[model samples]
Target: MLQRSPKDDTGDFLFHFSSIKIYNEHTLVAAPMGSGVYVRHKEGDWEGLRQGMPEDVHVNRLIIQTGKLFACTNKGLFEFDMICELWRDTGLVIGCYQLREAGGQLWAATPYGLWSRTGTGWHKIAYSHVRVYDFLFYPEFIILALEFGIAVYDRLVGVWMEFPFNEAVTGLAVFEGHILGVTENGTLLHGDKQGGFEQIRFPHLFLFSIVTKGSEVYACSDRGLFRISCIRDQITLISVRLGCPVTDIDCNADNLYMATLFQGIQRLEL
Candidate 1:
């Protein structure tokens, strides 16, 4: 059941949330840290969807690829079975941090390495021992935010390139044909095609996640949710304060979903 409490002055709901993702078209899935995953269909109340998952499973991220919903958790990767009303483990067994789709394939980022599903088996692509925080798919390369630096994998040449960064990147997104990244110390960086990055001034600090929608890039930070415009050569930022710290954010055609540190999930009209 979805807990209802008094809203703050900024109209923010009060519930702990770890991440949020849009499922299918009308369904909203949210992970409230240790409480497991919950689903809300169209104007319906949120319902827990932890039937087949392990007890107290901690989901780190949620993603939809090829019309199927997947959850990255501490136990491993699990695919939601809509027909069965439960989650089935994908048998990857290693802890997954994030899941992404690029080059018409599903990719999983884990502490062990980056793995991809091929046929009925999973293959390791890169980053065997390094930890990957996030990744983005460029034109011909797969860009990764690793524990210590940035890595770019060229698909056409079948080569991997790495560039060291002073601070660890916690999130990644692409804007206006340039790579944008948020570092662990809350610095926003803009990178070119050659893997060189330059710092851009960002007001809010302690940013954890970032996502791009259309010509705008939204970043989640301790202060609030900052929306950056990618329209002009110079970056512009607009802060949307919800009176709480935001941890993650996602968007679709109609709505922008925010996962807050103390609030469960808030949906805003775009």
Candidate 2:
């Protein structure tokens, strides 16, 4: 069992681990914010940082690289140094939505376009005409989720191919060739890069966040949270209260971490 820390705690706020990066130290850094971020050494170890940050700013997303934490804030891009205990402002684009590491590089979703960091520089991932939301890279291709729908980035052809998703995407998670996307009105949209998309039918799930443990995919919905197997095809209720407007859902090898709008953060023993 992990001991809880006084400072590393949460109240009533939405928490979703839509993005996670594990360090060499086994410390998992998660972006639990739709408008901010935090780091924890373990459960009950929440530390509010923005320590050396210049002013009050809201960070939408974050990514970790080279033993440092990087984020796109309302002000601009920033890197957090744990050793020096300081926040270094990158001062790049001010309108960034999300960040991910792919193909030995860091990729961020900016209002301008998709920005990729290679070594010490950043170049735009040109899309003909679209605002990219979320992305996941595989050995073969890269998948991008947008407001319009879900698309795949072809590194070979240098083009984007939009998959036939007819609804707006709220959140997405990639596992192998399959991508799980949550849509409005409590529907789960899943698509395979090789095959096509197939909606997994369930009860009244509010559809907030999507998470995966091995091949088991979990969904946070208004009605409640449900866990479904990739091959077994069984939808099991995880939690009802923890499902509504759920902010962050993260796991540390064992046990579960959940953050909700009404509930600050909840830990499940199993």
Candidate 3:
């Protein structure tokens, strides 16, 4: 188990981390506001790998595609060069918020729109007006949780479908065989393509992100981390109250990492 605070660790290096992404079982990356990126290589140690990045960079999201590390930041889409241990811009001028890998491509959620990168170029697929907060990918469709509602992109028909909700959405996930979304006010919503959305009475916290492990669903908010379970269309909070304002969460089979607004990154034994 890792200690909560190590003595050799200085405050300057562990800046306010926003996101955590695990590339493999033992490798992970932490995105910080001003400290570029910190990569935990396997089980050995964590190293700073921001040789060419800006000193005051805000890495909003981190993702891995084709065995390479990529970051979504205020600048644009960046790919980490493992050879030289530096970050290279992918020429996409996007102030991105979230990133996902689907259909052999990289999808980025930005204020402008949702951009997809297949080869070397980026293309705007849909939702040019709605500001996207998060995204989820399934076999037949892509769900994008917008600032106001949720948008579904039908891959078979090559069209977009809208499920409008009045409340602003903060996160999206595929849970319990349904499309699930969390509102800014921490209400859990399940979407039906023909029936619209129904609000689940979970909690009234400001939820930011949602992740899943097996059948269990986890949500992070200003209050803490909550474990939710959905059975027979009824959602129940199984466990909660972990750490402060968890901005992002990622986990492997053995360990889970949480990134907070103030506490850098916290490791939990799973």
Candidate 4:
């Protein structure tokens, strides 16, 4: 069963949820299309925690690293302090699309290229002209979903490589030990750091995001929520109706969270 979030600020159901992040086992934070951010604790109501944040800045993405919460917006990256319930600037003020923490370092993906944190400061690493949408972190490599193709940054060898798929990949995931790419045209592509990427034929899917829990992978698309399962040598996809387009999907231990285009948040039992 899907349950409504106890307290959503958009009483008129006009707010479109842009992104959601699982802060902890008991808390979750979400970014609305035009609002700052909202938080929900265990069995509590959703409330705004926008203090110390810029007024009317659109927050596009959220992530938690080492028990600290971070939000990427049109202005810059802001860190949320749990103790004060306030936000602090991280000083990479640009058009950031996504944020990731790998190798105990924070990485910012932007149109100006990629930036990584070293010691206490951030420095540019790669791609000044290309826009990166997502990342898949492995122990030895970081795979990026770029505007034109997939790029791999090898941490062990300190080398950069590119795989041009000629398709605009919107999302990336590591499922069953393979790098999966979700293209804007609704095709699924898989590849490894060594070999090349190949397409997986399925019904045209308008997917926006992809997430994995254990062996199961879930995708949020215009049609609904889909579960991708691989049994033996066969791949199966099952769609669940949401009656609304899903923009983002996330999961905790016991529940799956779906942020909709205009319906706020929907909680489903895991």
> What is the lDDT of every predicted structure here?
0.79, 0.61, 0.75, 0.78
Question: Highest lDDT, which number?
Answer: 1
Stretch of 10 with least lDDT, candidate 4: 1-10
Better of 1 and 4 by lDDT: 1
Please, what is the TM-score per model? 0.87, 0.73, 0.84, 0.86
lDDT (Cα, tens digit) per residue for candidate 2, span 176-245:
4467776654567767446577776565446766766566567765554567445455334455344445
Ranking by lDDT: 1, 4, 3, 2
Q: What would you estimate as the lDDT of candidate 3?
A: 0.75
Number of the top TM-score candidate: 1
Residue 181 in model 4: shift from native, Å?
1.1
| Model 1 ranges off by over 4 Å | 1-15, 200-204, 230-232
What is the per-residue lDDT of model 1 for residues 89-149, given as tens digits with 9 covering 90 to 100? 8888788888887777788888777889888778887888888877877788888888887
User: Model 2 compared with the native: what TM-score?
Assistant: 0.73
Model 2, position 47, has a per-residue lDDT of 57
The TM-score, computed over Cα atoms with residue i paired to residue i, of candidate 3 is: 0.84
